[model samples]
Target: MNERNRTVVTEFLLLGFGKLHNLRILLFIVFLFIHIMALTGNVLVVVLVVFNQSLHSPMYFFLSQLSLSEILFASNIVPNMLWLILVEGGKVSVDLCIRQFYLLAAATITQCLLLAAMSYDRYVAICRPLHYAIIMTFTRQLQIVIFCWLMGFMLSLIVYIFLDELDFCGPNIINHFYCDIAPVLELSCSDTSSVELATFLESFPVVLIPFMLIIGTYISILRTILKIPSTIGRQKAFSTCSSHLTVVCMYYGTLTSIYIFPPSNNSVDANKGLSLLYTLVTPLVNPLIYSLRNHDIRRTIAKFLGTL
Candidate 1:
């Protein structure tokens, strides 16, 4: 703990499920497939939103941005993760690790707020249909999407600043796939009380606020949906937001499991599995959830595929 005894930590060894030596190849293949599929699905969504005239609503616009965030999120972690999986573990310079941390944090925060924004869009569409056009104007939609990205990057910058101040000495082994804030801070010999405190405070705006907004919007949405007299009408109304709701549940469920109710100290492996769910699985499934459940996306994809 003494500054004089401390040695600068130039790099870190990511201890990605390295113990599964016999299954490394299998893990690599599976993840590679996931990475490819996630990228393709998200990219297809973005293209669908951009080029298609029918998909120009605020909802699909927000969906495209969400796909963009997923692309960044998945790319930031998966390639290096694949390498770590294949090699069992790998060394990364402090600088590269810090970059990865920032990217991952920004993408995650962006997606969280984007989901909240999408929920609000649904609330407006279903609850205040007459005023939806006025409220969700093109300019306002752009502003909202830009604000999400800006907030995400700005909050990440604050976390990075705190992390930069920490002093990491020896024991540069991170027991996860990526440089998550907690695991990275664990290696710090410096007093990380300030960093931890700052992170806790930052979580209010980054995670808590967006989650609360999503909850509030959905509550209103449910009330509106319930008010519709006909069962068929209610079914149609609920179907509109169901895909977004599903994605939100999956997103927050994994997040809450990993960060909120984090596994016990002895269950680090479980933590990794949860991380994999959000990082790889969610992105891969998001497009499927939207396209399969929603008629617009499926119809658009069918039209596009038939032309090929």
Candidate 2:
């Protein structure tokens, strides 16, 4: 911690799946396949929402934004990870690591804001069905989307500014597949208590604020569903939410553990696995969940594919 003993770390060695060195080739193949699936599926959704006028509701518009964020988010890490796994030399320059971290943070923050807006949209649609169109008009929807992206940029830029000041000295080996905040901060030669505290406090608002909003909205949504007079109406109401709820739970569940829970002796592996869940598994499943469960999307996809 002394200025005299301070060292400048020019690069970091990402110890990505270090334990699986012997199986690097296999891991590369698996991750590559996941990357392909996630990218293709999410992009397909974006494309459909863009070109297909029938799917251009407020819900689908928000969804396209989410899909685009996922694509950018996953790309920030997966491609680098695959490169590391294939080459088995995961060294990255400090500047490049910071860039990756910035992009990742921006993408995630954008998603959090976007998801909150989406939950509110759903809340209006289900709770105030008669006034849904007027409430969530094109202009309002566009405003929410813009606000989400702007907030994401501003919040993440603040974090990145703090991170940029930290000095990484020796032992520049990040114990994760990607340049995440915790690992990179841990390796900093300078004191990181303030930054760590800031991250912890901000994470609550960044993650749990949206999470709680979703919870409150869904509680009302569920109550409304139960009050529906007919069984088919109940089922229809429930179906509208089932996919988003599933994705929300899965995304928040993993992230909540990462930020809120006490770090443990085995936290590295646990965090790594959790990262895989949100980064890879979530995107991979999103397309399937929406397309399969929603009759309109299913029919649209079917008609689109029939042309191919």
Candidate 3:
């Protein structure tokens, strides 16, 4: 905390998922497979949405953006993780670590806000069909998407600027696979009370506000679904809402578990695994969930494949 005690760390050693000497090759293969699938699946979705005229709608437009964001998100962490797993000595410089942290934070926050916006779009479609078009116009959708990206960028900038000023002296090992804010903060020699408090304060609103919005939208949607006159109509509406709800639950459940709950002696492993779900598994599942459950997406895929 004092000038005499201050020291700067030039590089960081990542501990990664685990250090099973015998299972390094196996872990590499598993993560490599996931990285490939994440890339291929997300890329296919982006390409399909871009090329297929039939897939161009407010929903798919958002889906395309989500797919692109997921691709960028996974790329920011996974590849470096893979390199660390494979190479004998993979060390990251201080500047590089900060850059990775900035990008990862930016992509993640963007995805969270974008997903929340998409949920609202679905709510308007199912809950207020009459006003759906008026509420979610093309211009308005574009504006929302831009706002999401801008907010994410600004938040990441704030956090990273604070991080840049921190001095990391000795014990340069990061416990997790990627360079996250918390783990990085733990290594700093400087007074991190302000930084830690800022992180917590910023996280509260960013995490909860979008979460509350998504929940409120879905509640309205559920009420509308129940009010449908005929049983068949009710069944159809429920089926439609169920898929989106499932994805939302999986995403928000894991996300909240990681961010909302404080890190405890017993909860670190649980937190890491939950982080994997949102970072690796959720992106892989999003396209499959949408394609399997949504008739329009399935039909569009079929029609697109038929021509190809």
**Index of the highest-TM-score prediction:** 1
Give lDDT tens digits, candidate 2, residues 127-159. 999999899999999999998888777878777
lDDT of 1: 0.92
Per-residue lDDT of candidate 3, residues 207-281 (tens digit): 778878888998898898888889999888777666667777887777767666646746666666777676777
Q: Which stretches of candidate 1 lie over 4 Å from their true place?
A: 1-3
Q: What are the TM-scores, per candidate, against the unseen true structure?
A: 0.97, 0.95, 0.92
Taken over the whole model, the C-alpha lDDT of each candidate is 0.92, 0.84, 0.80
Model 3 weakest lDDT span, ten residues long: 262-271
lDDT of 3: 0.80
1 or 2: which has the higher TM-score?
1
Per-residue lDDT of model 1, residues 128-207, tens digit only: 99999999999999999999999999989888887887788879999999988888988888898887887789788878
Ranking the candidates on TM-score from highest down gives: 1, 2, 3
lDDT-best of 1 and 2? 1
Ranking by lDDT: 1, 2, 3
Sliding window of 10 residues with minimal summed lDDT for model 1: 1-10
Please state the error at residue 176 of candidate 3 in Å.
1.5
